[model samples]
Target: MKIIILGAGQVGGTLAENLVGENNDITIVDKDPERLRELQDKYDLRVVNGYASHPRTLEEAGAGDADMLVAVTNSDETNMIACQVAFTLFNTPNRVARIRSPEYLRAKQRLFLSDAVPVDHLIAPEELVTSYIKRLIAYPGALQVVTFAEDKVSLVAVKAYYGGPLVGNALSTLREHMPHIDTRVAAIFRQGQPIRPKGTTVIEADDEVFFVAASGHIRDVMSELQRLEKPYKRIMIVGGGNIGAGLAKQLEIDYSVKLIERNLARAEYLSEKLQNTIVFCGDAADQELLSEENIEQVDVFIAVTNEDESNIMSAMLAKRMGAKKVMVLIQRGAYVDLVQGGNIDIAISPQQATISALLTHVRRGDIVSVSSLRRGAAEAIEAIAHGDSANSKVVGRAIGDIKLPPGTTIGAIVRGESVIIANDRTVIEQNDHVVMFLVDKKYVPDVERLFQPSPFFL
Candidate 1:
C-alpha cells in the first residue's frame, strides 16, 4: 500500500515506523524540515517538507496514487482540510484524519460526508484515551483492558500477585480453580520478557499476565491472578483538558468526581458543563490543595494534564498522600516505562491508543479490531475467518492444526453471540471471529496471510 501521512509528530512517526516494515510505501509530510529529516534518517521511507494542507505538498508526497491519506497534524482544521484536499485533488481511496475538537467530533456524522470534510475515518485521541481509562476504572487492578468482537470478548493484563489462587500453580490448574468460566492465557511477560505459556507453566509473582475471555468472565479470571479489588467510587482528576473533562463528565454520575484546573476560566466553564462533578481552580501539584480535598479518601487520582512532568509529579504525590490508585497520562513513550509500577498505578498513552485505532484501518485481510500491547511489542487482533478448508489457512481447521507463527496464540473465537475459549480441539468455522495474541509483532504479516484466501479460490 502506498500511504501518505500528514504529520511528523509522534503519531505520524510511530505510524510510519509500524508500516514501513510491513511492505507499505510510507511518505510523511511536515512543515518542519528537522522532523522530516529525523524520520527519513531512521526509516526507509520518503519525507516531504511542506505545509501539510497545501496541494503542492500532497503532490510532492505522491498523494495522486497513494492507497491512503492519513492526516494527523496537531491542528484539527489542518487535518480536516488535508483530507478534503486529498480526496478532491488526488482522489485518494481512503482518507483518515485525527480530529481533536469535540465540536467537530460531535457533528462528525453530518460534517464528514463526501460533500463535506471527506474524511473516511476520524481518530480522536482524547476520546480514545478517555474510553481506555474508563475501561481500566471499570475493572480495578487491571493494567490494561481492551475489548473486541463488538464487546463480546475482552483481553485484560494484570500482574500476578502472591497468595492468589492460581499464581503459584501450573497453567493447567486454571480449570480446577474456575470450573464454570472458560478463559485462555494469551501470553505471559516475566521481567519484560515474553514467555510462551504451556500447561505446565507456573505463574510467578510480578509476572504480567495477559488473558482473553468473555467480557462477563473477565473479573472472575482476574481474581485468579490477584486479589479482586473493590469497585472504585471516589475519583479525582487533575487537568481540565479534553481527556480530563470528558472522563469527569462520563464518570460523575456513577462515581464521586472532582476536577482540578489550573486555569480559572476553564474551571468555571467545566463547572457549568458538568452537573455532578466538583470543579476546583488551583494547581494540581499543590500539596495544600490535595490535602484540603481529602486526597487520602480518594479512590483514584488521575493526572491528565498536557505536561508530562506535571502529570508524573502530581500522580506520585497523590499516591504518597494515600490515594488508593494513581493513573497518569504520559505523552512520551520513554516516560511511560519510567513512571509505571513505581508510584503510578497505570500510565495511559494517547499515542498507543491512536496507533491502535489507526492500525485497525491499515491492517489487511478481514481484521476488525487491533489492540497494541506492551508498548507495540505485542498485538491482539480480531479477524473474521473467510472461505473454507480448500481456500483459507485458518477456516475449517482445529486450533492445534493451524501453523501459527512463533509466539502467536489463538486466544478465543467469537461466533455469533457466543464466546468460545480457544483449545487444541476447537475447530474454527467460516465467519468465526478469531481473537489472537502476537508476542512478537514481526510475525504480523505471516498472521495476515493466514486469513487471506488463496489466489485460485473462486
Candidate 2:
C-alpha cells in the first residue's frame, strides 16, 4: 500500500512507524525539519518538510500515486483542508483525519461529504482515550479491555495477584474452578516475555494475563486469575483537559465525580459546564489539597493532565494516599511500561490508542476491528470470513486444520448473534467473525493472509 501521512506529531509519527513495518510506501509531511529528519533517519520511509496542507507539499510526498491519505496535523482546519485538497486534486481513495474539537465533530456529516471536506475517517484521540478509561472504570481490575463482534465477546488483560484462585495454578484448572463459564486464555506475559498458553501453562504472580470470554462473563473470568475490585463509585480526575472533561461527563451520572484543575479560570469554566461533577481549583500533586478532598476515600483516581510527569506523580501519590486504583494518561511510550509496573494501575498512551483505531481501516481483508495490546507488542484482531470453502482458506475448515501462525490463537467466533469459544474441532463458516490473539506480532502478516479470500473470489 502507498500511504501519505500529514503531521510529524505523535499520531502521524507512530502511524508511519507501524505502516512502514507492513512494507507500505509511507511518506510523512510536516512543518518541522527536525521532526521529519528524525523519522527519515529511523524508518524506511519518505518525509516531506513543509506546510502539510499545501498542494506542493502533498505532491512532493507522492499524494498522486498514494493509496491513502492520513491527515493528523495539530490543527483541525489543516487536517480537514488537507483531506479536501487530496480528494479534489489527487483523488485519494481513503482520507483519515484526526479531529479533536467537539464543535467541529458535531458537523461531521456535513464536513466529511465528498462535496465538502471529504474526510473518510476521523480519528479523535481524546474521545478514544476517554472511552478507554471508562471501560477500565466499568470493569475494575482490568489493565485493558477490548470488545469484539459488537460486545458479544471481550478480550481483557489483568495482572495476576497472589490471592486469586488460579494465580499459582495451571491454566487447565479454570474449567475445574468454574465449569459452566466457557472462556479461553489467549496469552500470558511474564516479565515482558510472551508465553504461549496451554493447559499446562501456569500463571505466576505479577504476570499480565489476557483472556477471551463472553462479555457477561468477563468479570467472572477476571476474578479467577486475580482478586476482583469492587465496583468503583467515587471518581476523582486530576485534569480538566478534553480527556478528563470528557470522561467526567460520561461517568458523573453513574458515579460521584470530582475534577481538580490547577487553573482557577479553567476550574470555573468546568464547574459551569458540568452538571453533576464537583470542580476544584488546586494543584493535583499537592498533598494538602488531596488530603482535604478526602482522596483516601476515592475509589478511582485518574490523572489526565497534559504533562506526563505531573500525571505520573499525582497518580502515584493518590495510590499511596489510599485511592483504590490509579490510572495515568501518558503520551510518551517510554513511560508506559515504567509506570504500569509500579504504583499506577494503568498507564495509557494516547498515541497507541489513536494508532490502534487508525489500523482498523488500514488492515486488509474483511477485518472489522484491530486493537494493539501490550503497548503494541501484541494485537487482537476481529476479521470476517468471506467466500466459500473453495474460495477461502479459513471457511469450512476446522480451526485445528487451518494454518494459523505460531503464537496466534483463535479465541472466539461470533456467528450472527451467538458467540462461540474456539476449540480444536470447531469449524469456521462464511461470514463468521473470528477473534484472534497474536502474542508475537511478527506473525501478524501470516495470520492476515490466512483470512484473505482466494483470488477466485476477488
Candidate 3:
C-alpha cells in the first residue's frame, strides 16, 4: 500500500515507522524541512517539505496514486482541508483526518460525507485519550483496558502483586481458583521482557500480565492477580485542556471531581461548564492548593496538563501526599519509561492512543480493531473471519490447528452475542471475530496473512 501521511509530528513519524517495515510505501509531508530530514534519515521512506494542504505538496508526495491519505497535522483546519484536497484533486481511495476540535467532531456525521469534507475516517486524540482514562477509572487497578466485539469482551493488563492468590501459582491453577469464570492469559512481561505464557509458567510478583475474558468476568480475573481495589469515588484532575476538561465532564456525574487550572480565565470557564466539578484557579504543583483541596482524600489523581514536566511533578507530589493512585500524561516516549511504576501508577500517551485508532484503518485483512500495547512492542487485534473452508485459512480451523506466528495467541472468539474463550479445541466459523495478542509486533504481517481470505472466494 502506498500511504501519504500529511504531518511530521509524533503521530505521523510513529505511523510511518510502523508502516515502513510492513512492506508499504510511506511518504510523510511537512512544512518544516528539519522534521522531514529527521524522518528521512531514520527510515527508508520519502519525505516532502511543503505546506501539507496545498495541491502542489500532495502532488509532490505522490498523492495521485496513493492508496491512502492520512492528514494529522496539528491544525484541525489544515487536516480537514488536506483530506478534501486529496479527495477532490487526487481521488485518493481512503482519507483519514485527525480532528481534535469537539465542535467539528460533534458535527462530523453531517460534515464528513464524501460530497462534503470527504474524510473517510476521523481520529480524535483528545476523545480517544479521554475514553482511555475513563476505562482506567472504571477498573481501578488495571494498567490498561481495551474492549472488542462491541464491548462483549475486554482485554485487561494488571500487575501481579505478591499477595494475590495466583501470583505465585502456575497458569494451570487459574482454572481452579475461578471455576465459573473463563479467561485466557494472553501474554506476560517480566521486567520489561516478554514471556510466552504456558501452563507451567508461574506468574511472579510485579509481572505485567495481559488477559482476556468476557466483560463481566474482567473484575473476577483481576482479583486473582492483585487485591481488587475499591471503586474510585473522588477524582482530581490537574489540567484545563481538552483531555482534562472532557474527562471531568464525563466523570463528574459518577464521581466527586475537582479540576485545577493555572489560567484563571479557563478555570472560571470550566467552573461554569462543569456542573458537579469544583474548578480551582491555581498551579497544580502548589502544595498549598493540593492540601486545601484535601488531596490526601482523593481516590485518584490525574495530571493531564499539556506540559510533560508539570504533569510529572504534580502527579509525583500527589502520590507523595497520599493520593491512592496517580496517573500522568506524558508526551515524550522517554518520560513514559522513566516515571511509570515509580510515582505514577499509569502513564497515558496520546500518541499511542491516536496511532492505535489509525492502525485499525491501516492494517490489512479484515481487522476490526487494533490496540498497541507495551508502547508499540505488542498489539492486540480483532479480525473477522470470512469466506469458507476452501478459501480461508482460519475459517474452518481449530484454535490449535491454525498456524499462528511466533508469540501470537488466539485469546477469544466472539460469535454474535456470545463470547467464547478460546481453547485448543475451539473451532472458528465464518464471521467470528477472533481476538489475538502478539508479544512481538514484527509478526504482524504474518498474522495478517494468516487471516486473509483468498481473492477467488465467492
Per-residue C-alpha lDDT of model 3 across residues 345-401, encoded as one tens digit per residue: 999999999999999999999999999999888999999998888999888889898
- Among all windows of ten consecutive residues in candidate 1, which has the lowest summed lDDT? 449-458
TM agreement with the true structure for every prediction: 0.99, 0.98, 0.99
Which runs in model 1 stand beyond 4 Å of their true positions?
none
- Against the true structure, candidate 3 reaches a TM-score of 0.99
* Residue 66, candidate 1: alpha-carbon lDDT: 96
Which tens-of-lDDT digit does each residue in 1-458 have in candidate 1? Answer: 89999998999999999989999999999989998888898999999989999999999999899999999999999999898898999999999999999999999999999998899988999999999999999999999999998899999999998887787799999999999999999999999999999999999999999999999999999988899999999999999999999999999989999999999899999999999999999998899999999999999999999999999999898889999999999999999898889888999999999999999999989889899999888999999999988898887889899889999999999999999999999999999999999998888888998999996753
Top model number, lDDT: 3
Per-residue lDDT tens digits of candidate 2, residues 148-233?
Answer: 99989999999999877887799999999889999999999898898989999988998889999999999889889888889999
Native-referenced Cα lDDT, model 3: 0.94
At residue 87, give the lDDT of candidate 1.
Answer: 91
Candidate 1 clash total? 0
Clashing pairs in 1: none
